[model samples]
Target chain A: MPGNRWALRYCGNMLSLTIKEVSLALREGKISPLELCRKCLKRIKKTQHLNAYITVTEELALKQAEEAESRLLQGVYQGILDGIPFAVKDNFCTENIRTTCASRMLKDFLPPYNATVVQKLLDQGAVLVGKTNMDEFAMGSGSTDGVFGPVRNPWSYAAPYREQSGGAEDDSEWVITGGSSGGSGAAVTSLTSFLALGSDTGGSTRNPGALCGAVALKPTYGLLSRHGLIPLVNSMDVPGIVTRSTSDAAIVLEVLQGRDLKDSTTVQSPTSHAGFSEDFDVRNLCVGIPKEYHAPGLSQETLAQWSRLADLLEGAGARVREVSLPHTQHSIVCYHVLCCAEVASNMARFDGLEYGHRSTEDSSTDAMYAASRHEGFNAVVRGRILSGNFFLLQQNYERYFLKAQQVRRLIAEDFEHAFSAGVDVLLTPTTLSDAASYSHFIQADNRTRSTQEDVFTQPANLAGLPAVSVPTALSSRGLPIGLQLIGPAFQDGMLLSVAHWIEQRVGFPSISNYEVPNK
Target chain B: MLGIHQIYGRRRVQLNIILPLLCRYYYASRTDNMLSTNVKTLRKTRNTPSRPVTVARLYSSNKHNSKVPKVPTWEPLGEDRIPSLPQVSSDLVDKLERLALVDFRTKEGLVCLERAIRFADHLNMVDTTGVEPMDSVLEHGQLFLRGDTVTEGDCAEKLLPLSNTTVEEYFVAPPGNIPLPRREERASMLKHSEF
Candidate 1:
């Protein structure tokens, strides 16, 4: 069986090329975008059991690819990303395509327009491969909470992509793809998409990417326009990039980050692009090791990888020192309060009226609203709304919501202090441990599991700092471990350069380069 | 929500039901209003039991919108310092249903609210003395506002189709309380007499 698994790895290399490799091939006229799009579509169909995608835009993808192919052949390409096949997390609205947010509420929701990011990619001639699956309303730590079923990690031990033994039940005892951006993470790592857009409200993108062995990036807040990316936590939400390598992530981020009139929260002034030159150096870097990130429940394997990277950085002529962010202990709790409050506020918009699930069997307007929400949303999403509403309550507003905001200020200030004190970037573990199995992941409640899993990632979202999860190495269990590098606000380029340096030194294994059997 | 029926006992539930009907009857007879009369008449002559009727909920939207929860007294743990749990109640659950519009009186919803409050109680341990609340991380830079000039308009034809229920020119919705119908009932009624 192991031999067969290895033999199957040789079935294709066309699906496994990175965005940079794919771009070179396209430019050299060795591979047409249409051919690549067809292969991507075929790969998606082959991996349908993984449940990584909610809607595969085969027809539209082919149409876009053909147009790109024509432009490429005619030597009138729009840009470097012209004809690159990429996927968008289902949360981003795609004009005339279903954007479910992986919730039953939007099971049939087709948006009237595309998200700003989606439109930008399309305008640049990037082919829209499909919309990836995610937690319902991007709310869970494990993608299992998504209505479409869990996005199984390609590297999970329950082999051949964690096919359920029960067949019908999605609750198989397999390793989880950390979420709420689990599907986007799965898509990139599994070679289903070259690049995928994942929204990082908390640790949604990094959590999943770390578990799935993909580089996940959350740019500084407002670096990317949030226009059509459905709001999870309006302020914390940023469109994250998922790719096999740091450079691929940097290339994608360069295209996606910009201001627009559609998203008011976009950074008003033009910010620096996250592109680093080929001669990037680590000598000038001052890396901070946040002592607060040695959080409880952090696995020894994860700590060893983090420390190993710190040693490597120090040995490579970069200064590494311990920095303390005292408010870190209180961040997870602060995140829950602020995140839930925003969730309740954003969810109030979905009442079975404006472009979502509508329950026709109900009589009263209130009944319809209640029935639609109850049926459309999963327990995780509904629970957040209820609790969020509790915080936003007139009486509790002062204690929960207001206090949370004040703590949020302190949290952001901690990052400000660390960055101002001459820390070019902070190094930490992306997740507490390697991916946990579905059986163990579900042992705790969604709220507790999310809190524990998202502890490291959430603080970055709260501080509105740019952070990236670079896949460091394989754990003893053969699952991937990722290390996070968080930079000061708008210093995304410097952060990527450091990440690229680490990525080169670590040389984490991507599926594309995995050794096949009988070579 | 079952309205007063959920809160009141069986004996009091009957009186609670009659009181709303009486108020509707009073509003129905007021000659200045006709559309309100139709809604009242629909409830008045219906043969079915008023089990699913929500006459009281129209005003319930604002009933407890301003009610605040009493903050629990915080106590330090034995050296480890785990924040003590916040006290959760059925009244809080009731308000959640009213405000969020989800049925939180269920076992799952109820458990979630209680657990979330317990998690949120962690904030009480921190000394957030003189910190001003940061509403948005974008507070350092102002939001880039566009001119007030019309950027998008005249797309009612495109917008109305997104909803499942739409009239000739507009989306069909229960405007505030009474669900507005397709075409003005009186205008159509005056145009053609029903059998």
Candidate 2:
């Protein structure tokens, strides 16, 4: 009778567990570490069809969970994440493990060290479930450009798969996971991991977060280290966290945020606000609405959602006003020039020499360099490299690179002016529209012509500010629409505080709303 | 304008003074002649001090003779006349023996010798401070070593004997024997040299 009672208690405890809940359960001796790991692995296997992970180290995870169980029994539990399972974008280096960055070039490369963020998470006793796939070198707006394959939208897992519906047969019907952090978002949504780390150059983290119905925070530039991240652009790339809730993202940020000696760009600052998980007051907050963001392409549904958000905030006693960012028009051009120039410089080191896949021929040095690059890199990456090199050439350097720098300065100044007008936060859509199908994304004029869709997101990257993408509404077709809140530099906590308040008020549905179809 | 008697008396007194002036002029001329004779005698005896007296007599007898031997101010020494010195001293030999003993005891002397060898090696590698002995070979011009040769001057036909050996040899290769051939010929040679 006692055994039966104990078994029932254990089963009841194991159901519906979060990180904190699991921690409490472990502390109370209601469940063993082996039991927790077993349940998580079972859930991961059951949802494998969601395609959330590129590699799952079941053996390693089980071994680590056993060690964690021993420590817990000895009353030496590490912290809140003592036995939690998490995943990271493949771009982040994991020691002695393959980190492909979803690109052919690094398809076989194994780093000798871990990314600082990954190292921190592991040190806090977080068990790594696997490495998630991402856009090729984290460059695309959709996760479809990966060398392995496109990551499907978890929201579309239960949607009816249409046959013979479109222009290109190959790209006919799958919904985009909204890259370049799409895999991280999907992994968390599918419950493959409690938290995932992703890099955000220009809305990569937030766009995927919005689309996958997860909470992702793009921390202030240099707030976290970028040492082991395969950089897209050194100046603007920030390693961010994507998780199921704002509190989870905050906990991951607290664990990973610090100054690292290997990454010189991360500035050493005083300790951030203690206990960011505490509730925040937003009654006197001022939210700014840039008139320019309401351009001609804003979908009626998105605009209506924005109006509803303003009304909700006003009802909650927050003041909202309209503002102008005069230099918003030049953001796309400036972003392309600067980002490509940086890409050209950063990619120059990957000439098939030290690591990565090498070419088969032992030809002349130039031939060797050229052949390896041509074989290793994909078409989109190659295009960016070429464009970056073109802008950085001697003749076009001043006209393209310098003009881009000037435009970047103007965009930053516009934000500065708006902030100086007593505005506490700025709100806008994460993207101009919701998730597009793969064919629509590929056939879109902007994707074919140039990288012009980054017009709204690139300015924040250029300015090196903090922004968070929180779901405000869902499309009629059941796609998540996110509203981003941009804050002043180094005010990430404040921005997150306001975002948390708005998240509570708006009450966006979690992944529980989406059903996982049985296989 | 004076009277004839005063003029005649003044003339007789002037004649007396004129007679003494003529006597003084003759004596001065005789003194100058004697001085010239002595100068000639001194010059003739200047070269051959051992035969100064005999050479003076010969010069007095035949002043126009061109067969007299002349003496030079400086003379060149032959190579065989240079002195030689011993290469090493007895004290140094004794010291070397003692150092050899120390070498047997602790190898300190061997280390010193090795350091000396290394120093010599460094010296050999360093550039030469003295004028290069092959400078004449490298430069295609009149080469001079320690100022031992001479060359042309401004005025023609005036052979200004150089004070030192300032002029060096100027080697001019025959036309066909030039080290660097013409460009076309060299190219042809290179083309034919290779298989």
Clashing pairs in 2: B143-B168, B147-B165, B147-B166, B148-B165, B148-B166, B149-B165, B149-B166, B149-B167, B150-B167
Q: Please give, for residues A63-94, the per-residue lDDT of candidate 1 as tens digits.
A: 99999888877778788789999999999999
How many Å off is the CA of A316 in candidate 1? 0.8
Model 1, B100: alpha-carbon shift in Å?
A: 0.9
Q: What lDDT tens digits, residue by residue, belong to model 1 across residues B1-195?
A: 112233212221342365433222111222331112111211322344444433322222222211111111122223235456566675665556767766653576677777788778778888988889998888867778889898888877767777888778865665357432222332232123211
- DockQ score, prediction 2: 0.00
CAPRI quality of model 2: incorrect
- Please write out the lDDT profile of model 2 over residues B101-143, one tens digit for every residue: 1111123323333322222122122222342221011122222
lDDT, candidate 2, A37-87, per-residue tens: 777688778877556677787888898888877777777878778888888
Candidate 1, overall lDDT?
Answer: 0.76
